[model samples]
Target: MTDAPGSEGPEPSEPPTSRREGGGLRRAHSAADASASTTTGARSARAEFETHVAHARAEFEEANERIKQRTGRDLILAIVIGVAIGVVVVASLIFFKWIFLLFAIAATSLGVFEFVRALRASGRRVDLIPQLLGGVVLMLSGYFVDLWLHWVLTMVVVVVLIVWRLLGQMFSRDGRTYGAVLSDVLITGLVVLYVPFLGSLAMILLSQDGGEWWALAFIIITVAADTGAYVTGLTIGRHPMAPRISPKKTWEGFGGAFVAALIAGVLLALYMLGLPWWTGLIIGAVILGTATIGDLGESMVKRDLGIKDMSSWLPGHGGVLDRLDSILPSATAALALFYLLSPLAVS
Candidate 1:
């Protein structure tokens, strides 16, 4: 080939670009370098992305582990408290006929206080006087509810609440009205009376019946139901029953509770309480239904207050009220059923 431009004969082998114009070869070299740099940058970005993902995964795992640890601790605490209180109550029943009734009244009072506090926390005003009056009336009438006082006290509650609301509006502050006061009073009365007041019936049944096997049976079945639901919910719950109110409650857990409650009933009745299978089954059904109702009721309360968990008073259980809320209704219903059907009713 002829010498390229000024180059001598047998021109040096230039790259394809410079072969035509040396400038072309220079541009080609630069393009290759730029492309290699871009590729290297892409690799570096990918590497950084992987590192970030690993860090996020580690944090997530750590959080889950901490949650699990807290859960285990709470469960242990619940068992201890339940066992201790149950032991004390059982021991007292031997020496006192109505000690648990006093306990029930005290619990009702405390529960009422807790409820009102929740209301106030949620930007609602609840005059303590009327609520306390209603609560006291409800408590006193607890004994006579099976007879004549229950309906009367309920009527009184309704009336007092209505009057309280009228008085409250008349005494409005800075154009603010206590319009919800009436509803609050009425609902609180019903909850305190029906839940804790009537719950005293369980105590009456056990202490007065000359046999506490039934009470023990109730404790066992309900405890089993609670345990089963909790355990199964933690592991296998997929479909939520009430996602907004109780995210943890699920159909799968409920089914597990039903089965566990039935098993608990069978064990308690046949082996411990020495009752017939039919009776055991009946008790199990009652426990299952009441357990669900109690849970739903408490869930409703917490939801109304725009809060999660009644309080963190009881490490694992949320609050004293939360833990006792379900049991109150369940205990009351069990006793009422006993008074109507059990051998204790023969008297």
Candidate 2:
């Protein structure tokens, strides 16, 4: 009021330091709040990213599963078709042994062709004519021609073909593929003889005194075993047994097959075809067990050849091998069973 100009201002408020310190406290609190917000935002962003990644992974898995399902359905379809044809053909040849024999020979020839194709797929160049002749010889060997003459023809054909092939290889200007030749021959032999050998026994069974019904029962048992395995595996399959070769097969499936086969055998004895369920039971157990070996054997061949199916002739079904793998071994067992039980032959 007295001296300095106008004594203006109003009280000067408080000291600048006191005001600044209050402002400083406010700034520090605000900065801390901002930092907390930043951290929370970062955590939320991370959680969102993780959720998106999980969604993507689940979608990928679902797509893969769908592909496998479609593949399995196609395969099952083919097998059913092929099996149906076979059942019809076999049923037709029920009485005429010669007609059945001819069918068996032709079927074996087709089988040999498929096997050679598999070998060739594995990079083996095989001579077709010699192998084809050998298969023909094997298929016809079961015919009841003049015993001595048939034997002579079989021995001569085998010797001449083998020698001729070997000489061709030894004198080849570009060298021969012994691996291919041997593999082709061996595969052809197995293919031609495998089913015919087993089927021929059924012929033998039917020809015996009043053994027609028993022969029919013999065929029925194999169908029963295969049906059991397929149905059971599709239902309660859990643990994968062989994913690389056969993804759908499970140990549980095998157990079911065994049980089904055993029951069918019993039924055969009791009612169906009048096989005497007790005898059917024994036959069932033997055939189912050995049939597993045949199934695995074909699997082994496919695995070695790096092939999925033996061929693509039948739609939905892979090849003749695919349909026959499990049943082929059963043929041998059935034949042996017949010899053991039938009146005509003794094993």
Candidate 3:
């Protein structure tokens, strides 16, 4: 037993080796020396462990400081650029219908470009020109025609791309690998769907009578959800929503998104889009679900390609795809709702 602090106790003493005349004295000295050695070693090891822990803590803090310094300017720049884009898009939708379509084409083209660049970075061979041409055609077709003709034009573009790929294979000996050619064809189709095909939905929405308001409502609800998630996640996020996919996203953030989206949906539906409050609530929920999936989908792509951002096109935004990740899937949902509950149907 050991003595308790503040209690009267004998001070521990080492048996003198010089008094090792008897067998009992020698044993006492040996036991004392052994105990003293063990205590010293344990203290030394504990000191070493604490030193290592302190060093690690300092390094972590330094890295965090560096990241904070770097992102400070980029964050401000990204916000400024984002606000400018929102104003331009809203203005175009209000005054110039043709300008809106042109903007969509440009954005769709850039989206295709970013996708091809990411594929190339991953050593995937993609025919850029054919995919680019196909994206433009897909957008123009959707903008000009009804839903039925839009599907026909989509098939026509796909067939043309198939022939275009075959012609390229015939011309280039090095591009004749069966696996590479197959990958190129599939990737071309994906680029179309991922960027232009889904993107054309925006044009479809805008072409309808009083469709600009519908388009604006969609944009506002989606943006609100994103903002809510980001702010909530940063403030109180603890449990990760998808740790393997997006470690930063949390269930708490999703809850925040749901609340914000619901409010935005109800208000926009009642005032802007001429729908009931209940309809807006449903739309908000749908958009939130689709937008979350879209963000995860892009994260999956980045994980597969072994790259951080698609490209450094936008400073803090990463790339066009990064910004459009939530928008594309939400756009598809919005388009479906428009068809089912056409705002123009009542009139």
Candidate 4:
């Protein structure tokens, strides 16, 4: 392999710098391709995740809508509010008994306020101040004083309400007829008897020894009954219990309520109150009757007033009265049960 002078051997073996530069360019191109592939894969993954999330959200919304249609209310909101109220009540009952008295007074006042507002909305004259004052006094008397004093104060409040209304009408130039005044007086009386009076019974129960537990027991059972009825009715309600009063109520619901109340009563009496198991049945039956009647009575009042609810103060609960309807009457029943069953409880 002898080469002549000035011969270009193997094309002078490509320059080292040029070869390095060419290799660098090819490597850069390879890197760019890999980056593009990675970006595409990331986009595809993100798109898939977004689609799954959207589908899940749609399913949740659909379920919520179905519940609303079946219950005529937002079930989730109702449950949340209901749980919050339960917590407050339980805390007040457990931590300090006096706190419950205050809670009751406040609740009754609000309920009376709602009722008065509803009555006024229906073109009826109502005295809100006296009702609130009377309710507070009733609860205080029941808690601090004796049952007799509570009754006496209740009568005093009634008379004051009547006189207040009569004097207001007498002085006013509205020309409201005597019959109208009478109707107003009657309604005022009803407001007292329905809310404060029954609610005071709970105060009386709390005043007694071990009465707090009884109060809690009855309340739990009442709530259980309400929950059972709501679930059963929403699930398989057919025959109307009171089509005229409450079309949503059904016999099936009532049956469910009965079973739930009985179970709750039995458990509470046996474990918490330490009363005979049979007493639980009695408690359940009595509370069920009273609660159902109270619910129906409130519904009848709403029907007469031509209002869907007393007020929309509580979002999912309608009004304070709406929530208290069952509890108010059940308070009286619970107090009575306490007296009758106290003898059987373990000392």
Candidate 5:
């Protein structure tokens, strides 16, 4: 090696870093950095997607697990009985319209029996004969008369029940307390409105032009709402709707019920009822409130009376009242709403 100018051995070779080369190097660095960033981002996105899928699957399994835990043979039996009753009701309404009245009378009778018997079980003596008579008359009035007559006859039946109770109390030798008589009268009146009054609306509903289809649509929407409530309550129900009345009910279930009712109502109005879509929505909301309240109201009765169910009239279905709990208020609401919306529908 030869000595270089200004110092040590041969001069060290300088690195090739001209302006052009330096610019190319910078570009290469930028490209490499961009490629690396792209790869990292892609990996992160894939990981996130996988996490989301896992979470969704887990939630689904949890919901199913809850259903599995809550469902049993009793529920299955209830479904069977309900389906049979539903088929009978539909056939009656569609094929033999008059025959539907017989079914209504029978249902009202049974509902009255169950209601009064439950009160009796709670140590409250109810005059079953007068109550049954009044219930039958109340239900039949809907068949024979217009809506106004129906109401008028309902008042007539109420007065008849009260008079009958008062006469019986006067004739009875037993020292019946005034409180007991008052309780008897009050409960008897409630039964009149609760069972036959509401059940009679079905007859009124059948009096409409497309009443047959309207009845079916009402049943379908009610079932849908009830299903939504049952499923949602079983799966994710956390907040109690009325814990004292119905331990199984929940706000989440109500939400599910509302959504299901809304969807069913819209579809039925559009395709079946020939009404405006909003009509179904409003009717659905009405039915939802009334049906839920009816259910809770009955539950309150059972709770207050200290009974599990009205009776075991239908296996696994508790009683006629239990199965018809939602039907009563739903029928009334549907009939009233239909008449309100369509003046011509009123008979």
Candidate 6:
């Protein structure tokens, strides 16, 4: 249809294909706008998540720094090492009892080695070879022989160490004096009695029927007390329990240790050892006393030796002796308790 000049004919109706094209374009634009909106929302969500993650990371770092500043050691590293030791011990204990014997032997040997080195550092002479050999024999005796034999062998080792030290002094090129020989003999006796003798008690415990569980129970309780003391002292400790010995240790921390030991003892007695829950109290009390004394005793030794650690063999923990201090004495206590409480245990 033709329209006159300056006049429209029926408003010039649009073509059908053109109208469809225009409608399609409008739909496409709407879709594009919706997609853009969705993308923006997703980006916002992602940014928020990242922000939260950053905040959490920052908080963790701050906490870690605080722990480091207070403890003079990396908390995470200590936990990792502690966990690794625990895994090895647990695996050896659970898989085979004899494997734990090997573990004990190795631990005692290392402890003796470290002690010898520490003494040597102080210019004191120690017979490392005899001590190591004697330690192995003592551990073997504890495992293979009866209780009486174990005691006899322990005394024999001490005497052997003393005599060996005396003979070495007599035959030495350095021409030792009586005072030096006496000191060496005394130190030798201390080493044998301290490391191997107490360690043998654990072997003895493991030799008994169902002794592995008791050993594990005592170990768990000791670890619990240590962990509780550490955490509590770091968080809210004020008054020092033994400032001259361990400045970081606090009464509050000791209380925490007591509580944790009590709980651990109860649980282990009831579940692991199949004993009366009340027995856990006794076990906990005994272990706590021994563990505390052991820790303090070691600290005193280190203070006298003028060293912060026995050695840096185990990172964040000092050395093997440092780790074994509590366990070594607790072993004796645990064995005694086993004899005392065996009647109450479930068969």
In terms of TM-score, the best-performing candidate is 6
Task: For candidate 1, write residues 288-346 as lDDT tens digits.
Answer: 78878888888887887888766666665676677666677777667765665466222
Residue-wise lDDT of candidate 2 within 47-117, one digit each (tens)? 99999999998886686455347345454454578578767656755666666666656666666678777
- Residue 224 deviation, candidate 2, in Å? 1.5
TM-score of 4: 0.85
Estimate, for each residue in 52-79, the C-alpha lDDT of model 5 and write its tens digit: 9999999976765555456421655666
Which 10 residues in a row give candidate 3 its minimum summed lDDT? Answer: 67-76
What are the lDDT scores of the predictions, listed in order?
Answer: 0.69, 0.66, 0.82, 0.89, 0.82, 0.91
RMSD (Å) of each candidate, 1 decimal: 15.8, 16.7, 17.1, 7.9, 15.2, 6.9
- Taking all chains together, the TM-score of candidate 5 against the true structure is 0.76
lDDT of 2: 0.66
Model 6 over residues 221-294: C-alpha lDDT tens digits?
A: 99999999998988889999999998888999999999999999999989898899999999999999999999
- Each candidate: how many clashes? 2, 4, 0, 0, 0, 0
Error of 3 at 345 (Å): 8.2
For candidate 4, the lDDT comes to: 0.89
Query: What 10-residue stretch in candidate 4 is worst by lDDT?
Result: 8-17
What's model 1's lDDT at 14? Answer: 46
TM value for model 3: 0.76
Candidate that would win on lDDT: 6
